[model samples]
Target: MSNLLAKLISMKYKGKSNIKEYIMEISNLASKMKTLKLELGEDLLMHLVLISLPAHFRQFKVSYNTQKDKWSLYELISHCVQEEERLWRDISESTHLSSTSQNKKRKKTKGAAEGSFQQKKPKKDEEFTCCFCKKSGHMKKECPKYATWRVKKGLLVEPTAK
Candidate 1:
């Protein structure tokens, strides 16, 4: 009898099952205690049900406490089911919103990187600067002055074009 009472008090809802099943399980335990000559009041049973719920039901518990009227076992089940649905909806919506924003940010960053790379690439008709002469229109390797200096220094053999 003491064991049954202790079990009833220590029962916790871990969300492994639906709210209705959890509440009914607790109710069954309370009924068993009653059969063993340990009578618990209806109000106490309601409070016990509330206490067994997890922290996710904190707002629901607070609302129940602040209300002027009390709820029966049936009303408690109904309200709890409604609150559970609302919580699930809120969770799904937030997850979707966050994922959508993340995808958009990735696309924007990818587009910006591609645009910057394209801007840095030189066009076919664009002029180049010669590092050897500090002039435009050709690169250092193709500079006329650099070729003459290389020929004078015997660093290059002049190609005879026919």
Candidate 2:
């Protein structure tokens, strides 16, 4: 870092690099270094993240908040990181349900392999009747849609489309 700072200071303008651009380049370098360290250890980055906010209120040596009363840079950052960590933990816990879902799905597939999820329908009579339309030619076993149509019209409850 000392060597990099010395190099940056020793750099000549030569009408080639703008002053703002040079300063920004230095800033970018510093941020990259910080990011590398943060990846290595979150506590280090977390501490800095909490302390990054500005101190807008001060009463002599002590500070006070004029708006909501309580405030400080480090405290604000700590709160933010705490909330963020809590949110992440909640999300991870919720996704754990998906693993249970996968397990349930596996059990269902295993039950299916055992051939217990299916039932044999009774043999159809010579003549069948439609439950909804009340026709005699086709049975309710043939057309699920027609059987559900009357129920939907009468009670306003839709059966599963599938």
Clashing pairs in 1: none
Please give the distance, in angstroms, between residue 117's alpha carbon in candidate 2 and its true position after superposition.
Answer: 1.0
**Residue 125 local lDDT, model 1:** 88
The CA lDDT at 148 in model 1 is 88
| Model 1 per-residue lDDT at 10 | 93
Tell me how many residue pairs clash in candidate 1: 0
Q: What pairs collide in candidate 2?
A: 50-77
The lDDT of each candidate is 0.88, 0.50
Off-target runs (Cα >4 Å) in candidate 1 are 112-162
Per-residue CA lDDT of model 1 for 12-67, tens digit only, reads 98877898888888788888998988888889999999998889889999999999
lDDT of 2 by residue, 1-162 (tens): 555544534544332443334434544555565665622133333233223322321121132223344444345445444544555587788799888999999999999889889754546655666776678777665666764765677854566768
Pick the lDDT winner: 1
* Model 2 stretches astray by more than 4 angstroms: 1-70, 121-162
